[model samples]
Target: MSQEEKKSRNGGRREAEPERREKKPSRRRRRAGISGVLLYVLFIIGVSAFLAGVGWVAANDVLALNKPEHTAIITIADGEKFGNVIDDLKENGIIEHKSFFWIFSVMTKSKDKIAAGTYELNTDMDYRAIITNLGSHSASRQEVTVTITEGMTVAQIFQLLEKSGVSTVEKLNDTAANHDYKFSFLENIPLGKATRLEGYLFPDTYKFYMGQDPLYVINKMLVTFDAKLTEEMRQQILDSDRTIAEIVTVASLIEKETDGTDQGKIASVIYNRLDHPNAETAGFLNIDATIYYVTGKTVTQADYQGVESPYNTYLYKGLPPGPIANPGMVAIRAAMNPDSTGYYYYAMNSKTGLHEYSKTYAEHQQKLASFGD
Candidate 1:
């Protein structure tokens, strides 16, 4: 190598020598000695400086997003991506730090595990709660449920209402029985002198608001029912030229026969027999439901044939004067939509709960006897 190159290499080596010398602490005593006390003093100053710097950075890094003027629910859906969730939290002022959320999600490996749904995120949430809600799935809905069991009379329903703190059952019954009430669906029989509506109370678990009035509760049920019974059903009745009330009356019969299965077929047979139009001058439907209503006690076929009422299809019938009980959509639909068949008589099989369908009356009579009547 040339002299310049040699000198440059020597200079590089010389520069590295000082770094090596500086790397180790000085072991050789100076003319003046450096004591251990001085070293501890330096360490204390350095630590204090470092702590002060950290406190300053943390203080400067802080920022608070203003809260909502009026609190509102913010839903973070299930299986939602972390990036979008951060945006939602920020947008709703539930959170201010994107970095903190991002770091938490990454460190916890929670990217794919975040639940799906409408989460109840509020401004009052702490940072941990905010993260927790985002990571889970549950909808925010206000629903209060009340149950109406099968075969409950309007009076019973009223009692249930009072028990639930909606209103006194007495008041509800009075309202239902009241002729002057605005809800005219009750108290107006199309062709009969029936005292009350028993066969029209649809059974199910009903949902209502906590403080809702009786009228609102009743109206919601009625509206839901009207929607369920399609317009086509109404049209079919109109085409058959049967009054709306008559269809309801038959629907009550089917509803009564149904606590067992084969409900649809048995219901169809009743319509078929009725279609003959006074062939028996009202052969009794002799349905178990009608007897159960009057006596408030369950009856079998043998105990059944003896009772009589205008509502009793067995005693006299074209159709009852009005609905015997509140029939649900299932029974009402059966009445409106009967199966076209040669089935003139049908009876429920007590053992299997299946209907034994027959075209002739004699076969049904034999089956009825076998029913342990």
Candidate 2:
């Protein structure tokens, strides 16, 4: 009876052990499958991150690479936004990828640091280099010195500006006629006229940058004029029963009439003719320079009497529509404070480079004969 019971128990235990071992293998298989799946997911994640890193590095290299050979000029106007500047870079071929440049700029917090100015850039400059350059003002400036002489016409002034490489004649003229300047003297200038600023460009030595905006160059000249025409002088001009325009016109006439040595005397002659006792009969200025100004030629008898432009002082009595040329501080002073000379006529003395004055027509003729005019 003991042997039969022991054999049955052993048989049951063996069967139970086999079932438990089978259960263990199934659990291990399940665990191994889960682990393999987890490892595969981690490997995929690592590969994706590596690809992103490689793309980022490539983008960074492209942004920092320069490919152009020659230099280019980029102008960022005042109040221009960073987005607009990025567009300009794209349009100018300075950057190939505007979206990337914008993104990098934003990430680096450099969008707000850009400055407004004329930049000397090149295709050889990378996006980062261009950004850094635009942030600095003096980095791209090319300064130039220009000396504008007194009694220069608007055309002449522009010619000088063009010659100095400070601006183009077309640009200067356009700016002079259209741009709104910040000055008291410009208040009376007719903005629509082509030659509105003809007489107001003060003749002086000026230092400017090459490739500068034409409006900025014009403003610099106007500021010089404002600075040169002192407060006291302006007050004097106001005290005189003449407008600033009228004074400038008269000064321009005096500047063109004779050399600076006899400016006061010539100014007196102009005033005498304008305010003569018999103004209706003898008020004509009859300035040959005015005729030349109208005809754009040296004064000839045909040109003098043929032209009917308002600038012809021989035809009209008062000052022209505006100044015919730019006048210096000296000429302006002479026009404002003329000598109390009774003479009403003047002619150049070719022998001495001085002028001969006369109170009568006969005396003027005699002096002209003596000067061999």
Candidate 3:
């Protein structure tokens, strides 16, 4: 009875072992399926994270958000390439991720829309704002206020314009020398010299765009001059023996000779010498400032004798070829109406800061000697 029971138990144990082995493989398969599903989910998560990072970077540059604050004058030269502009933006810290910006520009068709100019750009400006600012409109251009003083020469004015970022000196000089302005005053002034329009550019405060065209700049001054010389003054000039050029030349002399106090008195001396050629003066105006204009130096009497030029009034009989400096309205007015006097000679008294006039050469010499001349 015991042997039969042991054999039945052994047979049952063998069958149970096969079932346990089958169950072990099922559990292993379930664990393997679960691990495969977990790995697939992790891969999807990683891909999503990478795409999110890329999107964030693109959005940052496109929106110009979270960028460092910066302001720069972006000068886009004529026919400048878009790639070079992108490089400038990157260099100026106005933009990051230039490739992304370039792609954005291409998509928006902003590359060809940008015009040549100087624009004030800042990091606060979005990509679209930056592109909009680079257009040809006046609103897009940066402005500068320049004051051309009364006594500034054409060369000095051009240099100041260059330093003020209004325009380059080369451009100003080219326009001044070549452009033929249609004006009565400029009609006699020939081309090929920048100083031809020197006496006519009305000195005043002007507002100009950075990188402005030189033609427009010169035209503005010419127009101002045309407006400044009134109809009354023009008619008076026509009625008088002197032409506008001569009056302006005389005014330029008066401007250099005297301060604001005695322009009319100085004009009287000039007219006395020009209208009435005396034996002592020998028809030579003998003004010292004209020599300085030729040599561009502080001329003494010794320096004057050495200088030989049409502009040297000591050597020349009459007025210089053109106005030595652009005269202000006061000097111009003084030239229009001279003081009634017989004075043919004048000398500036350094201590008194005024001119003492004399009728004769001997009296002029005495007055000059009194001033320690």
Candidate 4:
């Protein structure tokens, strides 16, 4: 090539190379801009997805999920594990998801605080509210209060139990007859009677949960009786030279014999008659209450002679075989500590519901004539 032609071509090539470099940079910039736009779009999508996930978790963990309308009872038994409780709650439709509850409990540090009891829960409760309810003591238990009055017979007490829906009469009677109570007072209770533990069921108001076992109710009553019969009372019975059975039997008679005001004097009259050498008429006790106990009705003159049971104190000389009815603390205390009186016979004033005492049959007759029964 000629020198002039080479120089012109080289100059033209250099100018074109500068223009090519500029074009290359512009192409690179266009590609970089497109990549930047794509990266920004991806970042926005990731952020939206993260926000959606957070919203889902909050709805499930904190919000009130699907639940039923009415309240349902859930029994969390003793020593139940948290996993088992969650399973129970889920199975009972109290919660839609166990995982959400588990996560929420973990976050709130309430997994170990769940108490064991019978909880009445409603679907309107949120997860937090339900957790709070289960954790508290008073919110978890359902109780029924039963008031047993003084002098209630075993049959009457069982009837009250059946009426209160605490237990059936058959179940309560069976439990009272067969269940082996651990109380010291129950050690001497004989077996095979119609109502073996008849008078030992302490008369008082009691609070029991619905659907509790019949044995549990019986045990509670017996335990209450044990608690009420303090150590001093037991020692008093021992010092009186009488068995506990004798004292309770006498107390039951005293409870039926008169109004509660003069139990100590009535107890004294009973002791005087029992110790009198020629007191056969009064020593027989001829108690109308025993006849009522046997016949399940008021004692008539014929029933005094015709009744055949050993519980008929009218014919028997000593205390009855067992207590005829449950006596209150007053009668029990009166029996244990009788007043030292000389009276051996007594009659109740029909209008006054009070007793008139006498040392002889003629005096008793004069009192009855005065009272006009």
Question: lDDT, candidate 2, residue 276?
Answer: 77
Which one wins by lDDT: 3 or 4? 3
Residues 38-156 of candidate 1 have per-residue lDDT tens digits of 78789999999999976554333222234432222344554556788778766755565667667766876766656654444545565555656656544333436778765455656
Residue 232 CA displacement from its true place in model 2, Å: 1.2
Off by over 4 Å in 1: 1-143, 149-152, 179-196, 209-212, 259-261, 277-282, 299-308, 369-373
lDDT of each structure? Answer: 0.62, 0.79, 0.83, 0.79
**Can you write out model 3's per-residue Cα lDDT over 244-333, one digit (the tens) per residue?**
999888988988888778999999988888887755677788988788788887877876877878999987898899888878888889
User: Any idea what lDDT model 4 has?
Assistant: 0.79
Clashes of each: 15, 0, 0, 0
Scanning candidate 1 in windows of ten residues, the lowest lDDT window is 63-72
Q: What is the C-alpha RMSD of each candidate to the true structure, in Å?
A: 20.5, 16.1, 21.1, 18.2
Poorest lDDT segment (10 consecutive residues) of candidate 3: 14-23
Cα displacement (angstroms), candidate 3, residue 211, comes to 1.2
Superposed model 3: Cα runs more than 4 Å off: 1-135
For model 1 the local lDDT of residue 128 reads 55
lDDT per residue for candidate 2 within 1-373, as digits (tens), equals 5767867978845334433433456788899999999999999999999999877755653555435443345678879888888887777566767777888888888888788776656566666787788898753577788989999998998888899898899888887788766467777666865488877888888777887777667766775687688889888988998888888898999888877788899899888888874943377888888887777888766656678899887778767888888999888888899999888888778898878889888887888888865
